[model samples]
Target: MSSERKKPDIQYVNTDTKELVNLLIQGYESIANKRLYPADPLRLFILWVADIMVQQRVLIDYSAKQNIPRFAEGKYLDNLVEFLNNTIKRLPPQAATTRIRYTLSTKRETATVIPKGSRSTVDGKIFFETTKDLVIPIGETAGDIEAVCTVVGEIGNGFLPGQISKIVDFVPYLEKIENLTATAGGADTESDDSLYSRYREALSTYSTAGPEGAYRFYAKTANASIADVKTVSPTPGVAEIRVLMKDGRLPEEETIKAIEKLLSAEDIRPLTDKVVVKAADKVGYKIDISYYGFKHGQLSAEGIEKAAKFAVEKYKAWQSEKMGRDINPSKLNQMLMEEGIKRVEIRQPQFKEVSDTAVAIAESANLINGGVEDE
Candidate 1:
């Protein structure tokens, strides 16, 4: 979930315990027509009562904040989104899916059947099952079938081609099973931040004229894993929507098609607009940098080296997470310095501009630690 946007702190009422106690004591003195000392029984009773009032005030503030979208969380946030005019709802977790190829030992004389729900695995801990039955025709040794993860969410994502080759269910004449495409589209339950962002964009959906924010809202609603979207109109009546998945992964073909279908609906788009949906293009860059630490710094030389390596990884993640972010070595240098590095030399990625429809990705990384030197 995106944390770049900060929520403002809001409170409905004052909840200062000390101030509440003083107020209570003052009221008691005014009503009783006498001063109440600190050690007196009445003063102690007032203090106890003041504590309870403070707790209630704090709860009042919390409950009031839940009614606001920017401060809501959990089920409260879900309810807040539903309050939108378009009946927006929180997105649920989705499973990763890919195509698995079943190879027969030899060409079948008649036909070979791979039943629906046949399971395959890479490490045996997680499983992917065929979505439908597959029939291999005569003279064909293989057939490809769509498979979905048994468990939901991102745990089943990123399994590369040929990685899941082990078949759990026995299929007659099956020689091997392998995934043909990388698993994609797995995502956890929608986070509060992401849902709120969508809720804001959903405000534009009330317009039948099809605004840019309206298209962006529909594109993001297509998949839970979608992190960023850019909408552009290069020509009159032509609307192009670019989608970027979470963690810098490009959207799969299935995701693109889903977005296209949603945006092209008569109720969603204007009559004159031609809607197109596609994955955001990638701008590849490499990370090659050397960092040094101060000799008199708090950490030892070994500690500084470890910290510098971690900083590089963090910088790479930060740079790639957002669409249209430039390839900037200066950000890497700043991160390294923040991690106690005395100096840094970034030699690979110079500052390069990236278009709104493209994302900057680190193709590879090589970080060198130059040990410690005088500050």
Candidate 2:
């Protein structure tokens, strides 16, 4: 998702109050067959009517814009997607999940059963519950089961192993419980920009033949966390889909599997097509720059330094948010200049071209502020 494309903002009808008032005055003069001065009661009545007409015109323009996919929002966008229910639908918020390990106090004589829906949490604010029961076979000390967050969205993500160790549910003979893997795959509901992008691609899906756009659209629909998708046909009958998660994170194995299964469906993919889904590779880069502020500028040296540091962080985020974005030192310098810096000297990260199947990530940043200098 690149939102670089410009969307049209059209004014379907003029709602200028002054223009509407003039038009109403002209109509009144022609219908009454007499001149109407500004002081006349009839003229005042015409002004009031014009105000109402202007409001109606505004409503008309708003309604027309809502019908357009580029301009639609919220419920209006939902309605537009409903029109293509057969082909695509809006995605809901997804909960984060992680594998939890359950250990017994001792090697049990018989099987130890951890019931489904067992709850565990690091804090009471967020909870994770097992999706299925875990059975430690006879003489086994432990078993692993998958657990999902009780809440949806990104709030439940980023819990490292052992972060969630407290067990809320009582299981007889259970000694300890911990997360075996990091929590991931949580995402918010689909955004308006994302929905519009899919709508444009869905137009190409009417044909059974798998075009690049159609494949990309289906891949995006598989997961809400996906930020960008690149579809290519390396061979005659093979389609490869490369996925990039939001904030430059790679998609987990579960996310890749979900996309693979969705694309491999008999109705979704052509019988001759072999679909492969994988995460986009990352290309590492380092940001090393020194900047100075103008000596005679309004701000103090401390203020300028703070602004420069914030700009560097913003640049790093911009660089990693999109796939195939080249590592451009010129862009970094420009961002610093716009923040009231007098000059910038970039040392590392000379311009590098990133492939469509890869994204550039800034592994480390070295920002040196050289105090103030003459303009």
- In terms of TM-score, the best-performing candidate is 2
Per-residue alpha-carbon lDDT of candidate 1 for residues 183-202, written as tens digits (9 for 90 to 100):
87678998888888888887
Candidate 1, superposed: residue stretches over 4 Å from native: 1-5, 17-55, 235-237, 269-274, 288-303, 333-348, 366-375
TM-score of each predicted structure versus truth: 0.83, 0.85
Check candidate 2 and list the clashing pairs.
none
Residue 249 lDDT, candidate 2, scale 0-100: 84
Candidate 2 local Cα displacement, residue 155, angstroms = 1.5
lDDT of 1 at 359: 93
User: Candidate 2 residues 1-375, lDDT tens each?
Assistant: 246326555899998999888888888789989899979999999888888888999999999988877777888988977775546677889999899999988997899889899999988789999998888999999999999999999788888899999989989998999998888878899888788888888876786538888888888887788889998888989998899888788887767887999989887899999999988889999988889999999879888988898888878888888788999888888888888888999998899999988899889989888888888
Which lDDT value does model 2 have at 188? 92
**Candidate models: Cα lDDT each:** 0.86, 0.86
